[model samples]
Target: MNESALLAILLSLASAVGYALAAVGQSRLAAQGGGGMGQLLTRPLWWWAVGLNAAGALMHVAALHYGPLTLVQPLGALTLVAALPLSAYYARRRVTRREWRGAAWTLAGLTGLIAVTGPASPGDALSLSEALAIAAATALLLAFLVRAGAHSSRGTGLGHATASGIASGVASALTQTVTASLSHALPGGPLPWWGTSLVAVLVATFAVGGLLLSQAAYRGGLAAPLAVVNIANPAAAAVIGVALLGESFHGGPLGWLTAAASAAVAARGVIMLTGATPADLPTPLPTVLPTELPAPEPAVRITA
Candidate 1:
C-alpha cells in the first residue's frame, strides 16, 4: 500500500481505539448511576473519557484529510468491533455468544456497505438551500426519534443512541464541508456571506448533542446501543457525503441496492446485540454481614 493509505489506516485504527476506550469508560460511569449531567461531571474519569473522545475526533479529521470519505468513514466502524473486547475486559462484562454473533454480523455488513460505497469525488461548494434542507430534515427526524424514545416500550436507549449517531454523522459531514469550503477560499479572503459561520455553529451544536446522547446510550450498556450508534453515525455521514458532497458509488444502481441490503443486515445485527445486557452477566456484590454486630456492649455496663 502507498504511504498515504497506510497512514490513513493507522490513523483510522487509532481513532477507533480511542473511541472504544471512551465508550467503555463512559459506560462504566453511567453504570455507576447518577441523577444528571452535574452529578456525572463531578467525576474525573468522565473528563478523561471526554478527552479521549475529542482526541479520537481529531485523529478522524486527520484521517479524512489524508484519505477519501469512503475509506475513512467506513473505517470508523472499527470502533464497534474494537469496543467488543474493550467492554469485555475493562468493563468486566461478559461477551455473550449472541453478542459475538451480532458483532460479527455488524462487521461483515459494514464492511460490505463501505466496499459498495466505493470512492467519493469532491463536489461543488455547499449551497444555502441544500444546507437548510438537510438540516431541517435531520432536525425533524431527530424530534420524532426523541418522542418515540420517550414512549417506546422497548427502551429509549436505542432511540437516543441512534439519534446521537445521526447527529455525529451530520456533524462529520458538515466538518468536511467546512474544511473543503475553507480550503477553496483564497487566503486572506473574507468568509462567504451565505451562512458559513452559521453552518459552523450548527456543527458544534450537533456535535455536543451527539456527545450527550452517547453518554445516555451507555445508561443501557456498551454493547447494543454502541453498536447502533456505530452503524447510524457513519451511515448518516455517508449519506451526506453522497448526497451533498457529490460522492458516488462504483456500480451505480446495483451498488445502491447492495449498500441498502448491507445496511439492513447491519441493522439486524444491532438488534441482536441489544439482546445481551449487563443484567445477563454475573456480578460480584459485597458480602452482607449475616447479622448486625450486636450493638457494642454498653460502654461500661452502666445500664446495670
Candidate 2:
C-alpha cells in the first residue's frame, strides 16, 4: 500500500477506537436513563459522548480523504474489537469468555477479508443525480426498517439499531463524497452551490436520523443492539463503496467465496457477542408505557 493508504488505515483505526468509546458512553447514559435529546444537553456524559463521536467522525473524514471508501468502511468494524475492553473498563461490564471468542472470530475474519481484497485507489465524486438516487434509496430502506422496528417483537431493538447503522453508513459515504468534492473544488474559489446543497441536505438527514435511532437502540441492551449496529454500519457502507464509489475486490471466484466466508464468520461472531451479556446492566423500561404498576390484584368477583 502507498503512504496515503497506510495513513488512512491508521486514522480509521484511531477513529474506530473513538467510536467505541462514544458507544460505551452512550450506552451508559441509556442504562442510567432520564432524558431526551434536549435534556441530555444538561448532562456532561452526553457531551462527552457527542465530543468523542465528533472527533471520530473528523478522523474518519480525514481517512476517507486519503483512502478508498471500501477500505475505510471495513476498517471501522474494528470498533467492536476496541469496545470490548473499553466496555469492561468504563461501563463496568465484565467481558465474558464468549465475548472474547466472538472478538477473536471477528478479528480473524476481518484480517482475512482485508488480506484478500486488493489495495484501494482514490474514488470519483458522484453526480448530483447519482447522489440523489442513493439518498432516496437509503431513506426508503431506513423507513422500512423503522416501520419493522415499530411493530416487530422478536428483534425490535436489533431492527432499530440496524436502521441506525444503515443511516450512519449512508452518512459516512456522503461525508466521503462531500469531502472529495470539496477537495477537488478550486482553491480560493467559491464553492459549487448546487452540489453543495444536495450533499448538505442528504448528510444532515442521515446523520441526525442515525444519532436519534442509535440512542433508542441502547434501550434494549448494550451488547445485542450494539452488535447489530456495528455489523450493519460497515455492511451498508461497503455496499455504497462498491456500488457508487467504483471500488472492487479481486482474486476471481475463489476470492469472492473467501470474502463471503469471512463476512459470515464475522457476522457469526457478532451474534455470539450479542449473546454474551454484561452482568448487572439493567434493561430499560418500555417507553410506550408509564412506570410499571402493581399487577392489579385479582379483582374480587362480584356476586352474580
Candidate 3:
C-alpha cells in the first residue's frame, strides 16, 4: 500500500482504539453511579479516556497530512465499528443480534463511501470570512446544545447521547477546519496574523466542546452516543468537503448519489445497534444488604 493509505489505516485503527477506551471509561463512570461534572473529572479513569481521545485526534491530524480529505474523513467511521466489540469485552456485556446487523449495515455504507469519494487537494488557505463563518456556526450549535441539555432530565439517557453526538460532530468539523488553515499558513514561511488567530480560537473551541460532549456521552451510554457521534461527525465533514472543497466521487453524480444512499443505510445500522429499547439493556441487579440478610443469623443458631 502507498504511504497515504498506510497512514489512513493506522490512524483509523488508532481512532478506533481511542474511542473504545473512552467508551469503556465512560461506562465505568456510569456504572459507579457518579453524577455531575465534578464527579466525572475526579475519576482517574476518565482522564485516561480523555487522553486517549486526544491521542486519537493527533493521529487523525497526522493522517490528514498524508491522505486526501475524502479518504481520511470517511475512515473515522471505523470507530463505530470498533466500539461495539470493545464495549462487550470491557463491560462483559453481550451485543444483541440486532446490534451486530446494524454495525454490518453501517460498515457497508462507510465502505461504499470510501470507494466512491475522489481524491483532491485541500485549499491553500481559508478566507477570513470563511473562518469567521465556521466559528460562528460552531458556537451557535454548541450554545443550542447547552441550552437543550440544561432542560433535559438526568435519566433521559438518549437525549444526553444525542446532544453529545451533535457537540462532538461540530467540534470535529472545527478541528478539521483549523488543521486545514494551519497547513495553509505553514507553507508560506511565517504564519499570517489573521490565520494564526483564527486557528487558535477554533482549535480551543473544538477541544473544549469535544471534551464536554464526550463526557456527557460517556454519562449516557458509551456505545450509543459514541456510535452516533462517530457516524455524524464524518458524515458532516464529508458533506463539507464535497460541497465547499469541490470533492467528488469516482463515477460522477450517479455514483455520488449511490454512495450517499449507502451511507444512510450504514447510519441506520448504527442507530439500530445503539438505540435499544429498555428491554434490550441489562437490568440492574438487586442489592442484598446486610440487614436484609438477617435471616442467615437465625439459620446459623439452628445449626448449632
TM-score of each model, paired residue for residue? 0.84, 0.76, 0.76
- Taking all chains together, the TM-score of candidate 3 against the true structure is 0.76
| Model 1 residue 114 distance off true place after TM-score fit, in angstroms | 1.5
Model 2, range 1-304, lDDT digits (tens) per residue?
8999999999999999999888888877887877688888888988898899889989988997899866886787788778878878875557778887887776666655665665424545555666789899988888888788777532666778989989987887776567667776422332477877779788998988887788777766666677677667766766776776666666878877988998888778767766666344457687797678878778788896
Residue 74's lDDT within candidate 1 is 71
* Model 1 per-residue lDDT tens digits across residues 1-304: 8889889989999999999999989888878885798887788888989999999999998997788767887788888878888888875666778888888888778887878765444444455556667778888998788788876523678888899999988886666556666776423332485667877887898998898888887787888888888878868867876876677666999888888888888887887887766446787787975775667765665574
- What lDDT does the true structure give each of the candidates? 0.79, 0.76, 0.65
User: How many clashes would you count in candidate 2?
Assistant: 0
Q: Give me the overall lDDT of model 2.
A: 0.76
Which tens-of-lDDT digit does each residue in 44-145 have in candidate 3? 887887888778878877887887666676676677667777777776678777777877787777777767866535443334555567667756766666
Error of 2 at 175 (Å): 2.7
Model 3 residue 16 CA deviation (Å) reads 1.6
lDDT of 1: 0.79
Give the winner by TM-score: 1 or 2. 1
TM-score top scorer: 1
**Which window of ten consecutive residues has the lowest lDDT sum in model 1?**
185-194
